[model samples]
Target: MGADVIERYVTDLGSRLQGSRRQVRDLLTETRDSLTDATEAHLDDGLTEAEAQERAVEEFGPVREIAHEYQAELAVAYGTRTLVWLAIVLPLMHMAWEYGRMLLIGPWQDFGTMPPAWYLFIAQANDLTSGIASGVALVALILGRILARKYDTRLLAKVGAGVAVVAVGTVLLGNISIILATAHLDAARLVQSAPMLVATLISWIVIIRFGLLARRCLSCATIVA
Candidate 1:
């Protein structure tokens, strides 16, 4: 009977929250651990098993209130994870693509020197895309940590998600602009070889992965009911 109460409470709490699977599992595990410890302490104090469990549940607080707190934590965790990916993975992917290009194709011909000014502008923007995105993500993360307690978790989560989306969007647009410009100038450079094609595919995949994570952050934040 006591076990049933705990199981029921955990199930209900789990049902109320949504986010990364690993995060939800971890929080639920902690909930079980704390409740178990409380029950054991009550038992040591000489209460019957059922009575001890009942006492434990009471002290643990109502499930609805606990679920609200857990959901907030889940939202924050999801947002932080998205920010870290933006900070680290985006820049790395950009670097990898640049290095791959250099290895796969030698420096451009006179095109490198005499590309049209608009093309040059787009190329420079593409070069800075990842760095700018990563910098914004890092700043947002630091600010989030500083203001975490003062602001609501859901708001922080939504803000983090928005930043992530904008960052990724910037990178994506930069890449597209560079590619389109390159295609217009010399389509051959766009697909130098099979290896370059594969590298480009991988870069796109990484960007899509980050975009999905950012989307999930918003989903987790908005599900406040």
Candidate 2:
């Protein structure tokens, strides 16, 4: 009888959450343990089994209320994961692409038809953008840990999601600008090297993957009511 009530409550609570599978499972397990403990306490006080479970569920608060609280924590966890990915992957992707170019095609100076000053400036700026975005992600991640207990979970989640989106967007913006500038100046340069083209494609795929992550992070943060 008590198991039925606990099952119903846990299922309802689980339905409202969206996040890392391990995180969600851990929270649900903890909820079950708490409810079981509460029910046992009620039973020790002489309440019937059914009465104990009902009381435990009541004490756990309304399903919606509890779910909202859990959702906030889950959102924060999701944001943290996304930030970590951004911090580590962004710089590595940038470096890998740069190194692949240097190895496969030598320096840009090796090309007979050198690109103009504006193209070089754009390339340099794009490199700097990736570094800056990675730095921002690292700072946000560190501050998130430091302020975990100091700030509201929802606020932290929103801020983290926003940072992730902006960081990804900055990297993507730099890539697009450089691509367009290169295409306009010398379209042949874009596809001259098969190896570089593959590297560029991989870079674009990484950017798109993180863009989706940022979108989902924002979605998770937004639904924390």
lDDT of 1 by residue, 132-194 (tens): 999999999888887876866566676678888899889889989988899998898776679
Note the residue pairs that clash in candidate 1: none
What global local distance difference test value does model 2 have?
0.89
The 10-residue segment of model 1 with minimum total lDDT is 104-113
**TM-score, cand. 2:** 0.88
- Each candidate structure's TM-score, on Cα atoms with residue i matched to residue i, is 0.83, 0.88
Please report, in order, the local distance difference test score of every candidate based on alpha carbons: 0.84, 0.89
Name the runs in model 1 displaced over 4 angstroms: 41-55, 110-114, 149-156
Over the full model, what C-alpha lDDT does candidate 1 score relative to the true structure?
A: 0.84
Residue 108, candidate 2: alpha-carbon lDDT: 79
